[model samples]
Target: MHPAHPLLAVTHPDPYPYYAALAREQPLYWDKTLGLWVASHPTAISAVMRHPAARVRPLTEPVPRGLCPGPAGELFSRFVRMNDSRLHTRIKTLLMAYLQAQSQQACTPQWPAITLLSAVQADRFLYAAPVHAQAAFLGLPDQLHADCAVQIQAYLTALPANANADLIAAGHTAALTLQDRLESHLLAAEASPALRQLRDDGARDGIPAALLAANLAGLLFQSCEAGAGLLGNALILAGRRSLDASTTPAAARTVIDHVVRHDPPLHNTRRFMGNAIEIQGQRIEAGQTVLLVLAAAAMIEPDNAWTFGAHGHACPGQTLARSHAADALLHLLHAGTDAHALASHFRYRPLLNARVPQFDFSKDHQP
Candidate 1:
């Protein structure tokens, strides 16, 4: 039987080949075991994403009920990604405008890039640089970068449907820790304009302080999770192509765009049926799950598909994520080491939606 589970794409080293086969054979099919409809073709995925009947979460459950009464659940409930309400729309607009005002250089690194360039082992730098870039952008203190990453990973692990008890517990602990820290930081962080804006804007919009805190934390979680993966993928691609740090900004941006098109940081996301619908002859009842196979659709047409998302549901942080990744890759190329050396040995963190890379240079003294 064909591997019907989306997690299979996460575990397999090169799932593109499998995705190609599946896309050609069953572009849109129901996986009885998974209890979700998979859409592999670009057109089909786009159709579903923009469909009037599509939603980010189930209509009956606005937030994930399974994770509620805890920090993770609370954050998930307020997360812009999980809601379709008018409040979410207004908040997302404000966030996007804030993100758009940031120049590429503001998001990129210079001193850290130079530091990573001089490391005896670039492996740690490869991972650390992206983490630092994201942390800085989110107005997180440098001292908490490591702890923040750990907590974000825990939350990420517990996001999927089949997460175990251990994962859930860890996520809960991490969420509480993150919540406390974020709240404290927001209260005390008068120096950070972005945080201040989020607070002021949210208040002006009549949003509760707690929800504001959760959304701010959500920004950090997104940065740590997806931002890291995009940077890692760019490094791997540049290493393969022998691209150097001296590459022009325009050139670097092109490479970043290609990477997003070909091997995006996020492979897939799910949507719930908002109303009874017929998609490609398949009758999907309201509340049925639809897996938007972004990676698979990218295989078919990397240019047009909703790699980030579609219509009103698109990720507002796309530009920020790409700029950070491009800057890191430019520096990694200039780091005076063949970063490609690690490309062959690199491994991915097994995640259904994310594609973060993990590297260990201790085993091989490449530098």
Candidate 2:
């Protein structure tokens, strides 16, 4: 059975064929069911991404309504991923340079201590290990990596519009903790040269330490669901290939690369119009949302990292993300995780954009 729409395809057992057709045929069109314009082909997706009037966040609501008037809202708004301002360009350039430099540095990631690598614990590991790796990569102390993962989870839980008061409040607390920790780390005398360079560049450019620190936290935030999907899908591929505890990181990287080209993590991302625009002769009104089906674009151009997005809003952490997933995959296989069993029985989580597998039987079932 095929998914009814691109949105539903995230959890669908097989969506690539459908995505291929969307790129080849539909390209761009209105979906009354979703109340948005869908752009699947590379041409249409590129048109939307290149538009000056296309914004990452909605013009009327820069931050989610529920998160307004709070620390979480402030931190969320500061992230380069969520904006379309000059600040975005400056921070993005600085951060990209920082990541490139930092990738050359050596640091150890603290994998979560799972007493037993059951299906459920593997599910938990999917989210935790990536944050741990990313936090460590950012030059945060080893002891702080696990805590940073916990706080990132809390911050993520509070992002949805329907989050309860408790989650929202915890998110605020987590935001404060993350911001404080990253800021202090950034200012530490023993900070890495890459981090020091980042701080100095920010100061020279008039960017605040708080904003830079929030973006450091944003690096962890970026690693969560999409990272999970990458690692999870790679694990499935390893299992299918009978790669076990003996699989080296290099071998695991081979699987991860295959996943990137095939069962990639993110399926789509969105763009909000600051003004009305026309793409391929179809008019999208001001404030309207356009769904950019990156997976479909990948079907058209398998060589590109379409899942991370493109243009000004594209993710800056693609290389780091793949390396972390490879490391985490190798670690999980060696930890006695039954990759074959996991590969045999799992369901995709109900996410709108990412296709992360959940092994716990209690949650969403296989599509």
Candidate 3:
């Protein structure tokens, strides 16, 4: 197979077979068309992500120039996700400590009453649930969860490369709004344990106040669509397997794990090399980009998929992400709505790295 063959993970429907081909034939081959090295093997992908020399992006331009000169741009520049090892570790420590302190109830969702006709409602609820969960986890006010979710979603949608002009504009506006909200929360003398711990620990750790807000926004941005996709993919799988309310939670968890391995919400992430590194004896030059096929890696190596980035650049919110995903799936399964009822109407949002569901259940559509 030619590396020049289109490997458009985003637009291409069912890229698994293509990914499998790479895993079998060229686990560490460079794709000329994508202008990046593709890492499909667990060992290679882990090495790249965990490598000391591996950078989230080029140090010369941490955040894209186009996003600079704005609040959203500022946040992107300082976000731990894009920073070097030192800063990333600091922020990640503070963030993960705060997240882990949160009670299980805070991150869990109360499943909404659902039906075959509940597709639209399900879509809306799932979209908002993760945002609310994040808000609750951050010790923010429950009253503003709805508005906060919308702003975060807008901000996240405009984050990827080659985003539309309108989307970028909307994201900036939402960023400013969130900035104001977070600033107000910090101003108050009374703070929840989670927020208090974050501020105190972050400050002691030398994390700037402004940087904390930016990263918090970053957390929200990541959670918004990911939560939706996790549930959406699980629903599709459940429907195919004919799972229902009677299915045990343990069984539902198995379904979630399988989906994460096969059809993860975030399919791919990019990493840049800061120094020459060798992966499986292949010399990767400095400044070269490596694409981590997360989904494919998971399928090839089951253990690593569940604990993505376990060694280097671990997802600080991995526990919460898993809990949220499992909760969403359990709720849907317990809703007792037949998966088949929603199968034919399944629709996905057009996103580069994420798979978001957009339900289109009309009044005229019968179950």
Model 2, residue 272: what's the lDDT? 95
**Once superposed on the true structure, which residue ranges of model 1 sit more than 4 Å away at CA?**
1-7, 10-27, 59-66, 102-131, 158-170, 184-195, 244-252, 360-367
Better of 1 and 2 by lDDT: 2
Worst 10 residues of 2 by lDDT: 358-367
lDDT tens readout by residue for model 2, 182-296: 8999999999999999999999999999999999989999998899999999999998998888988789899999999999999999999999988888899998999999999
Per-residue lDDT of 55-106 in model 1, one digit per residue for the tens? 8888887766657667678778888888887788887876775565433225
C-alpha TM-scores of all predictions: 0.79, 0.98, 0.84
| Candidate 2 lDDT score relative to the true structure | 0.91
Show the lowest summed lDDT stretch of 10 residues, model 3: 1-10
lDDT agreement with native, every candidate: 0.71, 0.91, 0.71
Candidate 1 TM-score, C-alpha based: 0.79
Candidate 3 accuracy as TM-score: 0.84
